[model samples]
Target: MNCEFVIKEEGHLTQSENGPEVMYKEIKTEGDDDIKSETFPAGDPLAFEDTKLEMDQREEQEDGIYIPIQCSQTGENDFTCESLNDVSNKSFTRKPSDYTHSNEKPYKCSVCNKSFTQKGSLKMHLYLHSNERPFRCPFCIKSFIQKSHLNEHLRLHNNERPFKCSFCNKSYTTKSYFNIHFRLHSNEKPYKCFVCSKSFTQKSHLNEHLRLHNNERPFRCSVCSKSFTQKSHLNEHLRLHSNEKPFKCSACNKSFTTKSYLNIHFRLHSKDKPYKCSISSKSFTKKSHLNLHLRSHNNEKPFKCSVCN
Candidate 1:
């Protein structure tokens, strides 16, 4: 078997040339006549001796350059370009001189196939696949992949609302809430009347006002087709149709459609006037009750119809 040795400069490993600066030290070996001795220019003499030993070992084993080996046992050996193919075929070495890219990236991630250049990059990329943020903030306990990300998170502790609105001068920490607030300024005519020249901010409010104009009722109970504009109004109107008054006065046991009406009816039982008339000493729980009481004192009614005599 014939063996040949080739060496290039430190930085010029990738560069292919005829041969490196050769050494004249020739050894005529005992067993192999076809064996060729080659040398690399070395700054250190001991390193050159070790390289010669490794080349001799490879020649004796008759192994290809691409065959992977644990370089820790091999000591500081010059890495040959022929030995490395892609990144998958190599094993790592614990020795200080085994810091080669070809050996480091053994396992590639299936998601991106991104070679880590080191095992640690592959480990960190696994967190991205798992959605795991192991490193957490000490103050808030919010986790992050990197320490720099955790440092950026600490600034949120001071209640510093840096993202300011261009129009209103109102500030928000998050941009999402600020965008929702900005929507209120826009004249969005989402609710438009079908029969009249009118619009409203909300659909429900528009439908409520539309009932007074059109006298049309759309929403109705499933049990009964008797319709109404509002759901709450339909709910109350259904009580009139069924005569089912769930809201009852605790004082009188007289039920009503509304809790407010039942509260007013309870005051009727005790004769307790909580709401006093602004103009008079007469007090009543209901505004209508007080207004009715005030009517007895003053003969002039301002809300009287103009058509009435």
Candidate 2:
């Protein structure tokens, strides 16, 4: 004899008897497909229950299930399996606990020997060693390694001077440059030269002053092979090579390489005698003329008669 009992939505359980032994058949299905079938001896009920429990546990394990948990170090909520995988995939060979606690940097730059805790940071540092700039500006030929630096450089081409000073109506291309310019109005000289005890509003100025003490002229003229302490001086010298007079006098239509020369020319148009002799109360338009007049009062013969002397 055989008896069948339908289980909820799934296949049915069948009972069969042969002689003095009882047998049970369990069939599982999905929609119209037959999944599997198993037979359990009716005499051993405890063994059937144990087998079913183990099968349920195996199915749960096969589902690739994970629970969300808070990270012990970061205190952030993350998936248990994913966070473990992230820690395991780190470039360093140290244990996760050691990576979190230790200050030891296993990743070192081959060029500069600079050490970094993370491999990604070391990879970024390697860009500085190489001259390769993959990120190029669309407006200019300039290029940069990082996208953020390229974005900053683009502001110069766009003429985007967003930072403004409160004391003056002057604007700057960047907040850092604006802060440095503000120091001039505030009379703040934070950067001091250790050699001469001279102070400057900017660190770049102090660095340039240090070069003067060292007698280092890094900027050299390509045409004349003349060297200058400042790059601005080198740029002005280049104007002589190009014959490019940028500054022009409005009154005389005379051109000059520098604005200082144009300002001296302006005194001729305006008759502005700024330089005065303290002894004679006589004024001259040019400081050089006043200096020559002062030599007369002092009876100083700078141009000596070589044969008589």
TM per prediction: 0.28, 0.50
Candidate 2: pairs in clash: none
Candidate 2 residue-wise lDDT, 86-203, digit = tens: 3222211222222133476777899989996555456557878898777889987988866657766778898988899988789887788898999888899999999989999988
User: Candidate 1 lDDT, tens digit per residue, 42-126?
Assistant: 3222223222223232222221122122223333333433233323223322221232324454547988897744334466677
How many backbone clashes can be found in candidate 2?
0
Those runs of model 2 whose alpha carbons end farther than 4 Å from true positions after fitting are 1-107, 117-121, 247-255, 258-309
Best by TM-score: 2
Please report, as a residue range, the 10-residue window in candidate 1 with the lowest summed lDDT: 8-17
- Strongest candidate by lDDT: 2
Residue pairs with colliding backbones in model 1 are 65-83
Model 1 TM-score, 2 decimals: 0.28
Clashing residue pairs in all predictions, respectively, total: 1, 0
